[model samples]
Target: MAVSFHSRSNSYPSRQHPQAAHVDEQLTRLRSFEAASSSSICQRFSNLQDLHDSLEKMISLSVTNQVLSQDQIEKLLDGSIKILDLCNIAKDSLSQTKESLKEIQSIVRRKRGDLSAEVKKYLASRKFLKKSFQKVLKSLKTGQNKNNNALAVFGEAETVTIALFETIFSFISGSKACGKWSVVSKMISQSTVTCEAEANEFTIVDLEFQSDKSLKVENVQILEACIQDLEDGIESLSKSLIKYRVSILNI
Candidate 1:
């Protein structure tokens, strides 16, 4: 969050301004994140936060320099709005899923509630989350292959930003990428993910409910802890997005 105002974009003697150079460095890190051998959902969320934090700094530095024309600013703002929408959806999904998990967990604790009903309720929530992401990820993949060179304003950065969002969303929904965006093709994780092929807390809890129609108390507690971690990550990202959006609006 190294934000400042009113620095001229060309004040630097180097090929790129200091802040802009940082943004490029962050973009490179994020682009290679999905290729890492030990990537996780939490790590993905943290990288996205870093990218936007750098983006905020770079944008603030150029607010008074007119580096981006009116049209470019408008397009950039539109892209920011899309990013915010995706972030909000991720937040909501996590919130709802957490509530469902807590409800089922409560019933298990009481040991007297209608366990069957609660199990079904939680699984239904999971199914709906997956379906929602299906539509979202489909739309995300629409033009993912289009040339980034066609756009001049943060083209590569913007593409990577959306890919990061998609990667997180897919993990939240307990699914795999549709192979359209190869950036996330290496999203294989042994833990801290919700992918069907991966064995994380969420998938373990989901399997217990679907196959046995009950949850072990210890398993419920573990899943709730995992959900809390994800909730914190999503909340942090949502704040970053909203802060960046507000900055652009002021510009």
Candidate 2:
């Protein structure tokens, strides 16, 4: 929304700055991360982090100065800050989810009364997350106007930044990508589980609990590990975002 749009992604001249070319190269690599079937949301965001580092490096060297105006720079800084805010929101949400899961795990281990009540509480928290994600996602829906030219890197970078956050949030929110099944959906699909719930960690565990009156320790452990891995990925993205913001400030 901050940078100008181009009619074509490759509309720049054949003779381009080497530093800008490097940015184009990084963009290609970022795109490839999704093309590979084995790539997860964490992996996709990892590649995105690298791309920002490259963009920062180039911008620091003033390679993109020819194209970036002071106004554009201000927008870039503001955009980075908004993105960082979203990252923090997502991280906090995941932290809450992890803590809730731990609470349920404790309740199950105690073999205490009313385990269903705990699961329902966890599911309720998860339901709140879905609604929040939906609201934030709606606010971020800028139409597809991405460009890949060296002169257009600033615009393109923000596009990727917003796009990846949408993806990371969608994954946590249990929304499907490109109409495909979410990771949570696939994990629970083996059994004929039926529930009026979205495919997400909370719902998956809820179904598991419904199948039997108690939760499985292994499932809880697996989800915990999975959530931890995602948290690590988010931490990495947050660090990169901070560094990128600092780089912009220096400029």
Candidate 3:
């Protein structure tokens, strides 16, 4: 082989190879950094003023940042206080609403109790009236079965009629006082029976005594008839009251 001499400047090197181009760029960057460090001038004069100015700027920036941070913390605290105030107001409103509900509950219970008591009283009064009416009817029936005299029957019926009238008067008075006059009206319209009895007796000696006394037997009979009619009227009223017991008590 013939040896060839080539200049070093024209020689191909691995550093300049295509594959190592990226590595060469890195080495060039490193050399630049080194040159900048080596060739940098070292200032001889005092640069205290410039240093002071830079420090002042840094200090100002730090103080501004601290002020901004403090402002943010204050804003956060204010927001928390506002939220707490709102929560307290809501709690007070809820408490008032609960008290109102309790009051409403009490009113409803009291009204219910009052209505229940009235119904109980009405039922009791109705039962007593029914029992009394039945007893009177039974006594009348028994007397009729025994061939009782008309006078006795009339007297018994008259007594019962009087008792019934008194009872009706009391009921009406009580109902009116309670603002329940409808009860009295119902009793009058629904139930009653008229019972009348007539009897006659002739005495020969009684005629002589009546003439001496200037008394007319016909007048006596007329008066007796009138009294019987009055008793019958009372009986009719009693029967009417019994029939309307339910309606009257309802009022």
**Lowest summed-lDDT stretch of 10 residues in model 1?**
175-184
Question: Model 3 reaches what TM-score against the true structure?
Answer: 0.18
Candidate 1 per-residue C-alpha lDDT over 41-159 given as tens digits, one digit per residue, 9 for 90 to 100: 66777777777776666566643235544544566677777877877787788789888888877777787898888877887888788889889989987644233222232556668
What is the C-alpha lDDT profile of model 2 across 66-185, one tens digit per residue?
445455567777778878888888888989988988888787778776667877787778778878988888888854334445436766777776777777677776535322433255
lDDT of each: 0.63, 0.66, 0.29
| Cα RMSD for candidates in order | 7.8, 6.3, 55.7
Show pairs that collide, candidate 3: 191-239, 191-240, 192-239, 192-240
Error of 2 at 2 (Å): 20
TM-score of each: 0.76, 0.77, 0.18
For residues 114-148, what per-residue lDDT tens digits would candidate 3 score against the true structure? 43343334334434543553554344343221212
Candidate 1 lDDT score at position 159: 82
The worst-scoring run of ten residues by lDDT in candidate 2 lies at: 175-184
Is candidate 1 or 2 superior in TM-score?
A: 2
**Candidate 2 versus the native: TM-score?**
0.77
